[model samples]
Target chain A: MDKMNGAQLTIKLLERFGVDIIAGIPGGSNLPLYDALSHSTTIRHVLARHEQGAGFIAQGMARSSGRPAVCFATSGPGATNVMTALADAKLDSIPIICITGQVPQSLIGTDAFQEIDTYGMSIPITKHNFLVRSARELLEVIPAAFRIAGEGRPGPVLIDIPKDVQLEMIEFADWPAMPQRECVKHYRKQDILQAAAMINAAERPILYLGGGIRHGNAHDAAIRLAEKNNLPTTMTLLGLGSMPTNHPLALGMLGMHAARYTNLILEECDLLLVAGARFDDRATGKIAEFCPGAKVIHIDIDPGEINKLRTAHLQLVGDAGSVLAELLPQVESKNRQDWLNRMAFLKKENPFIMPGADDPCMPYGLIRQIAALADHETLIATDVGKHQMWVAQAYPFCRPRQLLTSGGLGTMGFGLPAAIGASLAHPQKTVVCFSGDGSILMNIQELATAVEQRANVKIFVLDNTSLGLVRQQQNLFFGKQYFASEYQHHVDFVTIARGFGMQAFALGASDDPVATLTKAMQTQGPCLVHVPIGRNEEVYPMVPPGAANKEMIGGENHASA
Target chain B: MQALKESYPCPPSDASGQKVLELTVNNHPGVMSHICGLFSRRAFNMEGILCMPIGDGKLSRIWIQIAGNSHLDQIVKQLEKLEDVRSAVLHPAEHEVFAKLEEYFQGS
Candidate 1:
């Protein structure tokens, strides 16, 4: 017979499930869990400054490794602090397991210190949640949490264990075996053949890829299908790295902030072969007019997502990779030279123009220089705002799991900590976080955590001295009444990084900006590079909110009006 | 509290324009909350609800009467995604589950 407390059992189960790193903070309610975790030799706990940082750090690990990662938080404030990250993960469909320590059973609803209804609060945000009543329930709940987090349509799962339950003793004869990933390959053959027929018959087809492509690990299959069918492909922000940005058929990101040519190509397509991508409003501006003339064939694991946004003519409910693999055989090899020629014409006419791409000091120019210096294997993470959009536009991401950003939640302060988590997951590879002034400050405390772990994360702060995206929105739509968007005073991120015991450099302060950036990138540990950006610089070819994809605002071709 | 209660009046329990969803779910403390939370968060109006344990108390059958609209399909789809919910079957307004319980709520 085996004997252990719930806390010990939980830690043991996590070790069995191959969880090596856990990011979290310890508090009164979760002391027993910390005590049990202390004895674990294999599981390394990363102490984050805030629970939110820990949550995002775990997100970083999960997003980079394509595995379910774990995080811990105490009850009440700790739990609340981590809620944002949980919601963020839920929206993006990232599999992450959060184990929170709750107040004892007796104190749960008695208005006790550090008591909150963690279970009730997490129900909406998590894919599945558990409130352990006894130590014995730990065995079933822990494995179930892992299963639910990683199963079909992966998402965040929460397990709130009361303190008394954590300390309760349980004796059992055997440990539960780890559950195998249930790969449901049950898709209709008729649907697949019909989708293939639609693709074969269509003269102009565009493959619209999203985060689901990365989640299903269908990058190679998607690329193959695109190339074989001679389909022009446009990716959503989350699906940036599915196809190499430099590929001939790659139209880059579509919808809002997309290149004029890409959105225009989408407008002209007769068929949209959507793989693992939901038609998010940002990706499909003015849904009725998104692809007005195109027939859609959407293949996703989640049945609910099929007709959730824009209804598909053919819905192939199965894993994206599996569906694509099946559809590949039925699809005929054809060179649609007419469509390609038209796309090339649009590209030549309405190209994505970087205004100051040649200068190393400009926003687009700096992103290009960084991309040039960084190796192909380097993982890029971005915080939300104009800088994130710029990186998504300019960065040449080549493979799946290459770029990690908060696509669904659009959370600020995600880049630095997420980059740290990625660096921890892959210690040998370089992790770069492209952040902006407004976004970086939201979780700047994590700089200390990055330094302490020596996570080898290079953070580049694109300092526009404002919430640039919000300011740009006010500029375009709100009559340029920038209220509460611009910062009155500037923050010196260089000195702040140095304060956190990190190597810091300022590109604006240096005579040779390239050398400064190179030195920062070459640094062996976590470093920060602050690049000053013009406040008025706006992301061009923006589809105004609620506007049609074809109705673009600013770009090279539309510079006058 | 009185003003708050007055501001949020009880939903009309009329069978007209109502759709019934029969859900088979795991019997647990938070299972009801999970179902109701989905409806509330999605802004779908629920008119009536009835739940009872089936057979061995391990599973429960919940009947939710919601206002029938274009969003009913979406509501059913979202309910099917819930982990605790085993199956969510939508029925037309004339479904007898909530109709049979109308007598209990008539004058209470």
Candidate 2:
């Protein structure tokens, strides 16, 4: 038996789990772990300027590779900084393991310097968290964290390693087997048959897709179900890439800001075949009135989500891929031409178009041009606000997991770090981040991380000089009395990028925006393009608060300023 | 923290307001934290919690005393969905687990 410190054993377990990269920043409490990391040749550490950036970077890798990713931080401020990302990952169900160094066990409750109850503070944010009291506990705790993080309905898990525990030496001889997770599917055979019967009988069936399809790796099953039955498909914000946007049967996203026709179709559908979706308030405006006359056939792996909100007529609790594949054999193929014709007519009668049609300097025109330049393999991420909505509305995503953005938490500054993670996960692929000026600054410190890793990520900052979403809401709902939303500073983002040792370009409102953006995307390693737009540009086709989805204010005929 | 307890929906005038939630879960390092975390995140307070390993070292049973509310049922369902949790059952407030434990502590 060989004597090894707890820190050394932790790294060995990570290696055993096939983790090659970790994003983190070191502090006083975590010096032992960093010391161990320095000795290891297998794990490459990317030093993030901030802990939150490291967390989101881990999220990006997990979302892209469909595997649990790792991040590290120290105690107190380090742990607090990573809180938002933990909450974000928990809500979005991305599998990530976060390790933070804690004070010695004896000093845990004495309020030692740089010590906060990392375990207690993390309870509300993490799916599970640990504070290792003994060196030997690492053997079980490390494996348990990984199991909880990567199992069904995956989420973020935390392990707070005390400084003394990391330094303690123990004679280690054997490694334990991984925890056993139950793979027993929970849906009854009769439920799938009943759902198929409902699908067969309904004349107008809309398949409501969600992020679970991507998590469950059920994209093929979802597309086959839609095409086999000639059913139209609609998506939640995180469900964008579940069905190819350009497919003939695909209706764009359905939500508060969804296209008018998609909402109209949802309101009229006789059966809503919901797959892997939790009926979020944003997706279902005024839940009482949403899909007023539809029988829902809900399929999800988490039994808790089956009837958490809206009760389903038939609930099938299993992996979306398995359930959909099983149900496919029971379903009989049929075409409803009258329903297809109605969809085509609605699209023709009321087309969903961006506000700016001709000028590339405008936000919509610039986003359209960028989407056109990228291929289906391109991975895109967005920060919160109007830019996120614009990209969600207009971008054409052709594959599952290609679009990674914060849907449940809607955290700002998620785009850049996430894009960096995606780029690092697949170096051969292109990753683009569409960000607002307000959001890019939230985690702007991560530009240094992207430069260090040489990640192939292109960041476009839409400088509206204000929090566009908040400004728009204030204008419509609060008599245009906007305060604190507007930025009074003259901060130059391109200068900041150049300062971080990255290639950068700043385009004026009239400068060839498309050409500059295209050049930046092709230039290589990491680059940024700044495009300024008017403050008044707002997202349209918005269903006001307390309004039904069909009562939209904008479409092709009307563009609200 | 006490304010969290006040928010629980009181039982109908005829029944006791407290209920016991029993959970069977894999005996692991951080399983307790996950259950407690769920309650903390929702701001749903539990009056008391008891945990003990079962026959073999592989599994454990947890009993939580909580005020009854509309949200309690949903909480039980979610607790059962955790990877470590095997089953979650609700018992009346008069269930013997807590009452027996109280007698043991008092006698000791």
Candidate 3:
């Protein structure tokens, strides 16, 4: 027989689950858990400055590696602090397991110190949650948490263990069995055939991909289906890396901030074959008018999402990879010459134009330069705001998992820590974070964590001295009443990085800005490069908040044919 | 109120306008909250709820009364997605479980 406390058993199970690195902060309620983690030789614990940073760091690993990652936090404030990351993960459908410490079971309603109803708070956000009543429950809860997180329609799962439960002892003859991966559920052959027939019959069909393409590892299949049918493809922000941005049929992102040609092309499409994508408002833009004339065929694993927003004429419920693979052989190959010609014409007439793309000082120029400096294998993470949209618009993401951003939550302070987590997961590969001045300050304390771990992350702080996206919104929608958006004073990010014992550089003060950026990228460990940007720089071809996708306002540099 | 009713027509008062959802769920402390939270977050209305442990007490059967609106299908699909909810079946509003209990609310 084997014997161990709940904390020790939890650590043992994590080791068995092959978790090598964990990011978290230890506090009074969780000291026993940390004590057990200290004895683990295979597991390395990374101390994050804040629970939110810890959660995002785990998110970074999960998003880049396409695996369920884990994080830890104590009860009360620690649990509450990590709520944003949990919400972010929930929205984006990233699989991450968060374990938190609660007050002892005896103090259930006594208003104990460091106590909170973590379970109640997390119920709405987590895919599944557990509150362990005894040490014996750990054997079941730990494995269940991991399984639920990585199951179909991946999402965050939370487990809150009280301090007494962590201290409880249990003995068993054997450890519980490891959970087997659930097999991909196949859809009916009739459904696949019906979908194929619709694809073959449509004259102007557009393949719409979303984050599920990456989560289901359906990138290759999605591309094959698009290429086989000669269909123009557009992606949501979360689905950016599913197809190479430069592919001939690729229309890049669609809806708000989409290229003029992309949204205009969608307006004319006779059919929309949406795969692994929920019709989010940001991607659809004025749902009633979105693809008004097109017949939608939504293929999603979640049945609820199939008709949640825009009703689909045809719905295929199954894993995206499996559905696409099954449907590919049945689809008739078509060149659709007239539709292709029309798309090419739209591309020629309403091409995406970056005003200052040639100069590294501009947002697009800086993103392009960074893309040039970094290899295709380098993963990119972006903080929320203008920089994020710019990177999404300009970055040449060529494969699945290439770019990680808070697409659903649009949360600030996500870039730096996520980059660190990605770097830690793939130590040999480089991870670049594109962050704005307003977003970077939200979790700037993680610089110390990056330095301590020597994570291979290059952070580019696009310093506009304001929340550029908010300011732009104010200018466009709020009658230019920019309040609480711009900072009166700028922060010295270079000095801050140095203080955290890492290399730092400033692009504005450099004799050669390109050389300074190159040096920063070439740095062996984590480093920060501050690049000054104009406050007026805004993302263009924007579909106003409540407007139709066809009513794009900007990006009209090229002359009409 | 008249203008509001004119713009958004109310459902018929007949029994055909309502539904009773029978859910078989794991009996646990927060299973009810998980099920109800889904409705609240999605803005789906649940007019009434009744739950009790069944069989060996490891599971519970819940009966929910709801309007037969456009969101009914979505509600059932979402309920089936929850970890604790094993099965969800929709029946006509005449389901005996809630119909027999109507007498308990008589001017109390």
Candidate 4:
């Protein structure tokens, strides 16, 4: 057995677990771990300006790659700064292992400098967290952290290592083998047959895809089930890329801000086959009226989600792909011309169109331009608020794992760092981050990291001079009481990007939008495009809280002729 | 650890109003955090918690007491699928394990 310090052991174990890249910052308490990380040959570290940026960057890699990613931070403020990301990961079920440095064990309770009870603070946010008590525990804890982060219902895991622990010497023995996750049990054939029987009997059925489909990489299976059963499909926000957006069977998203047509079709469906999605409030408005007449067959890997929100007539607890594969074999083919015709007629009557056509200076037009420019392989990540909803409603997503954004958490400041992480993970591909002026400033320091890494990321900042979504809400709900949504001063984003050592282009009212945007997109390494737009630009097709999906306001109604 | 367990007195329970959740999980660091975090995230509070390493130190058993509610069953199902949790069973609130412990403490 070779003798090594605790920090050395931790890094070696992380390497043994196949951790190729880690995002974080160095602090006083965690210097030792950083030292070890610097010495390691297998693991490359990306230095993030803020601990939160590091956390989101790791999230991007984990979410896009379908593998657990790693991040690092120091004690106290570092740990607290990373907390939001931990909660975000927990909400979205993204797998990430976060390692934070702590004060020496002896000073933990003495109110030492840079000391925080990270383990205690993290208890409510992470799937699990550890305060390392001994060097030997790393042999078990490191492997367990990876296992817990990647296993059933993946989420963030934290390991807080004290400085002394990092310095302590231990005999290094053989590392543990990668732990195997317990296999989810296959659904009973009888249950699958029963579900198939319901599917065959129903005249109008809709397949509902959720985030779990992306998590399980079951998009193919979901598409297959829809095609084989002759079912039209609707997606939850996180399930956007499970099938091509333009597929005739695709009814787009349902629920709040859903297409008027999609909601109407859902209202008329007889069978609602929920695949890997929890019926969240945002996706199921006025729960009682959502798919009112439809009998639900909920399939998900998490048993709790099966009947927690809306009761399912048939609950199938297993991997989404496995369950769908099983049901596919038993499903009988059918043709429902009446249902198809109804959907077509409804779509024609209530076309889901937004403003900004032929005007690249406008919000919707800019999104369309970005979509048109984006290669089929390009990945898009968005910040929270109106931009997120607009991208979800407008972007043409043809594959899973392509759009990495915070869904359940609705986290702002998720775009730049996540795109940096995605860019790092896939250096060959282009990664675009769509952020608003308000959301972009939340963690703008990450632009430095992107420039340092020379990450192939294109950042497009939609500057509306206000929190556009909040202003819209106030306008409609609060009698146009704008409040503090608007910014008082002009911020030159191009100067800020250049200050971070990245090339930037500022597109103002007089500039030709297409040429400037195209130049920014085609530039090598990291670049930022700043576009100034009107503060009154609202994401339309708005649904008031608790309102039924059919009660949509704005969008095509407010479109300028 | 045993002394710490005894310091906190167990609250009384009524069968109709209370619920008991017994879980068996692989014994390892952070398992407790994972279990407790789930309930906290759901905004549910545990009336009492009892945990100890079981058998050969490879696993442990935990019992959590929470108020009975319409969402209890769904929460139990979620607990059963937690990363290292091998099993999660909802015991009758009248189960005397904690009650017996409380009785012993009072006698002593």
Pairs with steric clashes in candidate 4: none
In order, candidate lDDTs are 0.90, 0.86, 0.90, 0.85
lDDT of 4 at A497: 98
Q: Residue A387 of candidate 3: its Cα lDDT?
A: 95
Ranking by DockQ: 1, 3, 2, 4
TM-score of 2: 0.92
Candidate 4 lDDT tens digits, A1-561: 879988999999999999999999999989999999999999999999999999999999998899999999999999999999999998888999999999999998999998988988887778777888888888888998998887766789999999999999998658778878765654688899899999999999999999889888888988888888789999998899998898889988777778778887888889999988999888988787888899999998776687787889998877888888888878887667888888898787777877776687777788889888889999999998787887888888999989988888888899999999999899999999999999999999999899999999999899999988889989989999999998998789999999999999887843678888888888999999888878887776777878877677765533333
Interface RMSD of 3: 13.4
Question: Whole-model lDDT for model 4 versus the true structure?
Answer: 0.85
TM-score, chain B only, every model?
0.80, 0.75, 0.81, 0.75
lDDT of 1 by residue, A447-550 (tens): 99998999989999999999999999999999999999999999989899999999999898899998988898899999999999999999997999999999
The deviation in Å at residue A270 for candidate 3 is 1.1
Which 10-residue window in model 2 chain B sums to the lowest lDDT?
Answer: B1-10
Residues A57-87, candidate 2, lDDT per residue (tens digit)? Answer: 9999999999899999999999999989999
Candidate 2 chain A: minimum summed lDDT over ten consecutive residues — where? A552-561
Q: Write the per-residue lDDT of candidate 2 for residues B16-107, one digit (tens) a residue.
A: 47788788877976688888877876677688899999987899999998876536656766676555677777774557788777866675
Candidate 4 per-residue lDDT, tens place, B1-108, comes to: 000011112234453577777788879766887788778777766878899999999999998878765367656665665556777677755567777778555753
Return the clash pairs for model 1, or none: none
Count of residue pairs whose backbone atoms collide, per candidate: 0, 0, 0, 0
lDDT of 3 by residue, A1-561 (tens): 889999999999999999999999999888999999999999999999999999999999999998899999999999999999999999999999999999999997788998889999999898889999999989888988888888788999999999999999899787877676575453579989999999999999999999999988999999999999998999999999888999999999998999999998998989999988998888889999998889999888776787888989998887899999998999988999999999999888888998788888889999999999999899999999999999999999999899999999999999999999999899999999999999999999999999999999999999999999889889898999999998998789999889999899989999988898899889999999999998888889788998888888878865553
Sorted on TM-score, best first, the list reads: 3, 1, 4, 2
